[model samples]
Target: MPVLEIETIRGVQLMTMNRPKSLNSLNEELSSALIRAFHMASEDDEVRVVVLNGAGKGFCSGLDLTTVDSIGEQSSRFQALDEYGWVGRLALAISECDKPVIAAMNGIAAGAGLSLALAADMRYMAASARVTTGYIRRALSPDAGMSYFLPRLVGPNRAAKWLFTGQDIAAFEAEQAGLVDEVYADGEFMPHVLRIAYDIADQAPLALTYTKRLLHASFDTDLRSQLRQEFTSIKACFATEDVAEGMQAFSEKRKPIYRGR
Candidate 1:
């Protein structure tokens, strides 16, 4: 069976990590498949927004430890680097994708799986779902961009506590810490997430893309540089047909029909 499943509803592309037997653990196949899926969504104009979730009981259980033995057998250092690089690429693809990526966490997300959830622009978690930084428990450090993303999301102090303890963070506490945007009852999670995704998809696509880019860049760029970028992006947006449609709709007292031009 396929390790990942892709589905589209309206303009939102939903990518499901499909390894229920293992709680969607990241193996070589699933990692590569996710990289491809995110890249495809980045380039696909039809995809206005992307929602990532997992099948079965958990969102993702982190790395498949069984594969670690074989990975260590690589004769050359470069081979080892290349193999490990795929995990970074998967995280990068999600963060850099033009369309806003939302993580809909259905259950437990631990170790690198938590990193994956943090990579998304927004996260909506199920009430029963939980997340943990499990590296310390295994006598390992964090990977899959966990150190970078976690600190930024929850601040250095909270991140340190979580990383050092490897404690499970329930959905309510996660929301309070600002790690997740919203928490819904398990039964209502998908429906609410889809509704939000569709709402975002209905907006001007170019505007959404530029806004996403600006938000991500804000962390690294100075205020002056970010303002310049925002100025340039908005000027470009004005040239698109969607802007005219939006103005027209306002005048007509009707919803704008954006073509994403």
Candidate 2:
């Protein structure tokens, strides 16, 4: 069976990490499958948005430790680095994808799983879900872009505290800490997430992609450079057919039908 299950509803691609027996832990197969899935969504013009979640009681429990233990000490260190590098690529792909990615945290997300969630453009977590920087608990340091995404989302100090302690963060606290966008009741989580995804899909695709790029660039760019990018991007958006349709729709008092032009 495929380690990852993919389905599309409307223009939103839903990618589920499938490994319930292991709490959706990352092994080599699952990691590679996930990376490919995101890349596929990014390349597919029909896909306007991506939603990532897991199947089972937990979102993900982190790396499959069994895989690590099989390596000898001399080779384990190098193997570990290579494994994390692959995982990092997956996280980076999600961040850099053209389509906005939303993380639906249905349950516990820890270690690298937390890193994956943080990489998304937005996160909608279930009220019963929890998150943690689980590396410290296992005497491991952060990897899979956790060190990169966590600090950007929650600030350095709070990230430091969490990484240092490896403490479990409840869904409500995560939302308040800016680690999650919103916390929904468990029963309403998927519906709420899909609703937001559909809303985003309703906008001009080119505009949304440009906006996502600009937001990500803001972290590394100065105000002047950012303004220049915004000017260029907005001008490009104006040239798109969707913009014309949008303007016409407003004047006609009807909803715009974007063809992703």
The TM-scores of all predictions, comma-separated, are: 0.96, 0.94
Listed per candidate, the RMSD to the true structure in angstroms reads 1.5, 2.5
Where model 1 places Cα greater than 4 Å from the true spot, the runs are: 73-84
For each candidate in the order shown, give its overall lDDT on alpha carbons. 0.93, 0.90
Question: On residues 171-250, what C-alpha lDDT tens digit does candidate 2 reach at each position?
Answer: 99999999998999999989999999999988888988899999999999899999999999999999899999999999
**What is candidate 2's local distance difference test score?**
0.90
- Which tens-of-lDDT digit does each residue in 1-261 have in candidate 1? 899999987899999999999999998799999999999998898999999999999999998888777645666777666744667888998899899999999999999899999999999999999999999999989989999999999999999999999999999999999999999999999999999999999999999999999999999999999999999999999999999999999999999989999
Top candidate on lDDT is 1
Q: After superposition, how far is residue 97 of candidate 1 from its true place, in Å?
A: 0.9
Model 1 steric clash pairs: none
